[model samples]
Target: MKTLLLLLFLLLLPIKTYSAVIEKIEIIGLKWTKEKFVRRELLFKEGDNFSKEKLKNSIRNLLNTHLFYKITPEVKEKDGKVTVVLKTKERFPIVPIPKFRAKTNRAFKTGIEIRDYNFRGMGNHIFLGLTKWFKNEHSERNFYINSMFYRIIKDRIDVGITLNFFNSYNNVFTKDNKVLGNYDLKSFKANVYMIEYLDLEKIRRLMLSFRPEINKYSNWIESTNQYYLSLGFTVDKTTDMVYYTEGSFYSFYIDFAEPNLSTVFTGSLIGTYSNSLKRGNINTLSFGGSVGTKIGYSGNGFLLDSGIPGYVSDKVKGKRFFNFKIFYRLALINKTVFIKPTIAGGDAFSNIPDNFLISPGFEVEAFWARLVDGIIRFKIFKGIGSGSDVQTSLKLGFRW
Candidate 1:
């Protein structure tokens, strides 16, 4: 009896002494991405206790990067030590976009752009593009250099900057459906922004930005130099795969400009929020609202763009606006393609419940999985109450 008891004690002791410690981590199938970049997204490192939740979170973070085509996780445990292996298949990183359009007596523009999402195996982005506009058989060229993100410290902080040179022409119109005036603008602008991620993924964060511009206007106004600063905070809890399928997002930003320099505004505030849910593969529903107010604003370029199908942004005008919107999308082709429909009602005035705008519209989206910018979209919309019009357009790229 004593000998039998001793053997049972030995087996129980081994079980009691075992601990699920991470002994090693191995990342595979990386050619352009660095191992450190993958490690940064992980919630645990070597010699740490194992957690299934953290492993799942790390996978979520990686998927949100949109840097991989497929990811498979493998785990092995022996004598309570765990070894994890993550094998990944990367997507094509280099993306190019070419645009062309020509319509008589309308504003049509063209551009060519190239972007690199991952620069030098580091998680950085850079873009170079050129745009040209045609007016009365003459072409105006625009030059720009944009850097989307550059990590400078602690992996969570980033900076972005842009330099743009342009010769632009635009027509100003009044509410009476008549042309007010036209202006030619020769301008140079510089923009810089910084972002700090509160989580491993930038789905929630804080943002600060500055834009300084110099404009040389032809006969409409004098040349001027002006700048503004914007600060915003966002809180988001969304699961991203192919696209953000469900969850909630809330954000607000305030803008401040030089006093009496450009009348862009002394200060302005905007806030918005949305919550979404997925109902099987049938559809995803999202609802949200936004409010805006401008201090010392001209209210001339007022726009109400809710991504609702039947309205153009510039047709609405106001000094302050508040609106509510509902959005829906039907999933097809494994959620790679979507049928999006939207409805919104509100006005850019004090009376929110009376005589507001109601817009309803829908669009079809298709994507090619091989290319980064392979999304194509067709949209149609109609509005009731205000800015009512029938509009349809087709576009290529991922802007929507």
Candidate 2:
């Protein structure tokens, strides 16, 4: 009786294990981007077992590339075999964009940039622009050029390279808003990075980067040349790179500056948590902070204008500093529009005032979901210090 039962169990196992296998992958829609590029983004291939989750993630990965306007995946099963069909609509490769920004009590800048998103149909990008700024009854100009190239190998290793160049004349200011000098600056920067996807869960990514930069600054007072080598590592578990509704990101880097300038170590942490409130409304809380210290003799440290609103870069210079900000965002229109209020405070430990600074600000933002996948933000800030004032800014930029 035992032998008969074993034979029956073995026979049923074959029937239960019979599942549909992917027979063919048909990609419909390729005007500029190649079929190989599209296939490389997919998570599954022919002869693999069909999974609905992988198919969904494959569509998401393709959309994340920002090259497609529309994507639809269809699975058809016939005679125990499955076929996957992907339909996509490509975006216009070349876009001529006009950029403008206005900051209260600071500068107003405008420029026209022409960007090619799908360079040679290989998911590369290149842009060139010329910008002019008007500030304090003086005019400054800058020329910018940038290029980014991305490649994926074996569905795991993600490689990218960025080249950037800038030439400009910038006004140097002291911490008390006094004009120190003006510098004619020319800089060239290049970065090479690789991201290794650890597993199919997509829960963790390891990032490694190396950047080399050279800057030449000339002024009536003196002339200086600075060279820097930066190495970075980051472990990211964030679900979204653009709109961070949840998860955390952490990064650490070390910079070595030549000519006895400064050797600095910096680290940052950012976290976001979201909850569903009443009536389909969502509330998100985000916090980010960074700390930096100089290891050697600090000649002149860079500005710490980030992590705190309402503070201009020219008014803040430090060698060792710590800054943090907390933000609360309420989705007013199903996450398409948000009312965000933030409170930020930070302190410099060296080379500046040793007092902590605080700023309270609010912003109204609209997310362009269909057209460009960007955000338009209008913000107002009030700084509470020994003697400070209110500032406002208008920003039009990409998300994340």
Q: TM-score winner among the candidates?
A: 1
- Evaluate residue 101 in candidate 2 and report its C-alpha lDDT on the 0 to 100 scale: 72
Expressed as tens digits, the lDDT of each residue in 109-201 for candidate 2 is 888888777788878777778777767344656666666665657767667666666666654745477777766677777777777667654
Worst 10 residues of 2 by lDDT: 268-277
TM, every model? 0.84, 0.73
Clashing pairs in 2: none
Q: What is the lDDT of residue 297 in candidate 1?
A: 53
Kindly state the number of residue pairs that clash in model 2.
0
Candidate 1 clash pair list: 309-381, 310-381, 310-382
Model 1 worst lDDT window (10 residues)? 300-309
**Per-residue CA lDDT of candidate 1, range 1-400, in tens?**
9999999999778454345999999999997888888888788899998888889889877766667767799999999899999998776777888877768788577888887877876668788999887664345778898886645677888899999998856645344887766667788999899989987656778999999988888775667877889999998776655554577889999887764445446667889998888866547898999887766555443333334335556444455677787878887677478888877766665324344678777779887554556788888778885667888888886631
**What shift in Å separates residue 106 of candidate 2 from its native position after superposition?**
12
